[model samples]
Target: AQTVTQSQPEMSVQEAETVTLSCTYDTSESNYYLFWYKQPPSRQMILVIRQEAYKQQNATENRFSVNFQKAAKSFSLKISDSQLGDTAMYFCAFIDFGNEKLTFGTGTRLTIIP
Candidate 1:
């Protein structure tokens, strides 16, 4: 069984600053993929970043980056220079190679304070 945890239920960051959202997961599988998805009021899950279990390098996309600590089963998202548009409900998800379903964590509502 695989489970994802987001300890923080809510987070607030000042505009133009940086914020890191924590996420931890438990899994017995040796191979998998971790993802950070942001869903705003519209409820569309947007892929923020993803890391493959075999990849040594942390995945980064522009201002969104993930710190993938494989051994610890920790995957956290760091948003640099946070913007108002970044405010959303962030979810951590996991998926194995053959599975089409995503196991998601309790979302963390992030607010960008101006």
Candidate 2:
């Protein structure tokens, strides 16, 4: 069974600052997919970034980026120049080859202090 872990229960960052959320996972499969999803107060799940296990390079989207360590099974998210809108509950998830279901971590509640 593959499992994702977000060690931080909550994090706070001043507006316009940068924040990094930690995430780690345990998976036996050599090839798979990793994802970071954001759920705001509205509770809508939004894809932040994604990384394919085969790719050694991390993924980036605007202010969002990932540090993917396949050998260590660790994937973390970094938010640069954060804004108040960035406040949300961030979840790290994984998808197996055959299973479409996403296994998510407990989540890290990120609060951007304005």
Q: Tell me the tens digit of each residue's lDDT in model 1 across 1-114.
A: 889999999999899999999999998888899999999999999998889999999999999999999999999999999999999999999998778879999989999999
- Per-candidate local distance difference test: 0.95, 0.94
Candidate 2: Cα lDDT at 80: 98
TM-score quality measure for candidate 1:
0.97
Q: Who wins the lDDT comparison?
A: 1
- Tens digit of per-residue lDDT, candidate 2, span 1-114: 888999999999999999999999998888789999999999999999999999999999999999998888889999999999999999999997878889999999999999
Segments in model 1 whose C-alpha atoms lie over 4 Å from true places: none
Clashes of each: 0, 0
**C-alpha lDDT of candidate 1 relative to the true structure:** 0.95
